[model samples]
Target: MATGRSTVFEDRSHAGAALGMKLSTLLPAGEYTVLGLLRGGVPIAHEVAKTLGATLGAVAVRKLGVPSNPELAFGAIAQYGPDSARHINEAIYRRALQYFGKDELESLERGTGADLLALADTFKAYCPELAGRDLLLCDDGMATGATMKAALDLVQGLAPASIRLAVPVASPETAAGLAPQVNGICQLLTPDNFTAVGAFYEDFGQVGQDQVLEMLRATQ
Candidate 1:
């Protein structure tokens, strides 16, 4: 069952811990895996992993942002093992690209090479033991959900028994959009006036590469 309600969180850690408590009471006792979407998702997943006593891993997804506003995403790419998948909002992508001229658009596409490679490396490093286990796909929050959508697509290819999306906060519309795709959902907050994911967090700092690697290493 997909359940959601509005709630406030102190920080990523607090939200993770609170969500973990709720999940503990809801999920049946069994072997489960906790896979956090890389960057911001890692911190929240760390707490969930600890609370649930599940192995932790990372799902690398890079959003293809609007050239002018990097925070707004029109598409995203997710990589795992040797495979990569992309999800694009063509309506937004077409409109957003108009801001950049031909030369700039070409340059932007070329710049994606390094990021795509890094996403592949991160996926290979963090993903293993994914088959035949109940999985929790987590993030700190979701706005447009393009990246998380990509993450979900990648994980589905791995043949997990079940996949549930767990996020600290998400807009009601985004939560509803994701509900039918996954087996279950655990969104602590579903604000109607959602502007961005960071707006709901007190300490939504960037998660560095070193921190992500260290968090994954600790689970192994």
Candidate 2:
């Protein structure tokens, strides 16, 4: 059931705390890691990692959008690992390369070797070695799930035993679409009238790279 209307949570941290409390139940106790999408997913993932006693890291994902409308994301770019940095479909990326500058495009292709890189740096920092571990993918919410999907698809190659999608709130339709991609979906609130993901948060500010790094540092 959903409200079909937007409502704000206390803040990104509290929103994450609510979601993390629920995600902790699904995970088995072990040496696992929680990877958050940059800028938005970091705070939420940090709270979850704290609750589950897991390592906090970042996963890099870039939204593929229509050439004219860069904001409309059609898909995402998932990096291979922290240092692994492998991504699929270089051809498609080449098609979209014009949308970004050389360094920006290369950073996406290489995955972790960019400086002052805004969001992608998250994955490079936390899960540099992406193989042979349990990964819980956390984000604030999903509007279309395309970006999250791309991340999951790319991560599939690195071979995590289990991948989970955890969030505080999301569109019911989007959550349903992602159900098959991951091992489990633990979300607290689903709004039927889903628009932008930020609508559900009062303090929906951008999650900065340094902030994400700090969250990762705290867990370490």
Candidate 3:
């Protein structure tokens, strides 16, 4: 838990370093694969992979947000290897169906699935084999946690020996909800009054795809 209303980190790298150090103490000694959610998570996972001496990889995930409000996610999708998974928020999805025809919603989901596949294709070379390996999933932070849940579903299908989640900050509710689903969780901050993931960082700029590719390349 963080005290005061001050920001928790200078930037993503700084946050990643802090998170990596914390994870180092929590995770046992073993071969681990660090998979960062694409874009923002790549840089954070880069630092964590360095700290843990683990192979770095990226997971491409996309939120299926409502067409009217792109920020409000009704579901999410994630991909690893040739496998993919989706998680739909049942409550939200039910509400969405009230205002949207089944065909419209299916079309939206298919389009997002195509986008996820494209990203997976672009990142295929950097992904590592998951079976019988310990996995540490990294992300910049978790707000609603829909995408992280989707990522977890995708990876669990691959039969890893274990799975843990690491993040710099998350809301208390989100952290608690996800705790039971992972072997362990490493979180630097879980503010009770959390508004958004960006609020805890001084430099929470949008991460571009080029930056993600460069980070993945450096890890190779």
**Among these predicted structures, which one has the highest TM-score?**
3
- Candidate 2 backbone overlaps, count: 4
Measured on C-alpha atoms, candidate 1 has an lDDT of 0.81
Q: Rank the candidates by TM-score, best first.
A: 3, 1, 2
Pick by lDDT: 1 or 3, better one: 3
- For candidate 2, give the lDDT of residue 183: 84
Tens digit of lDDT per residue, candidate 2, span 1-220? Answer: 4666565677779988887787666667777778887657889888988888787877766665545565555345555443223323455556666667656655543443342144444345466455778888888888777667776776777878788888888778879978987888888778766778878777887666677778888877
Residue-level lDDT for 33 in candidate 1: 94
User: Which 10 consecutive positions of candidate 2 have the poorest summed lDDT?
Assistant: 80-89
Write model 1 residue lDDT over 48-112, tens digit each, in one string: 89889998988777887778887788778887777667788777787876767657755665566
Ranking of predictions according to lDDT: 3, 1, 2
- What would the TM-score be for candidate 1 when compared with the true structure? 0.89
Stretches > 4 Å off in candidate 2: 80-123
Q: Distance (Å) between predicted and true CA of 60, model 1?
A: 1.1
What is the C-alpha lDDT profile of model 3 across 117-200, one tens digit per residue?
998899998889999999999999998898999999999989899999999998788889999999988899988788888888
| Candidate 1, residue 149: how far the Cα is off, in Å | 0.6
Model 3 lDDT on a 0 to 1 scale: 0.89
Q: List the residue pairs that clash in candidate 1.
A: none
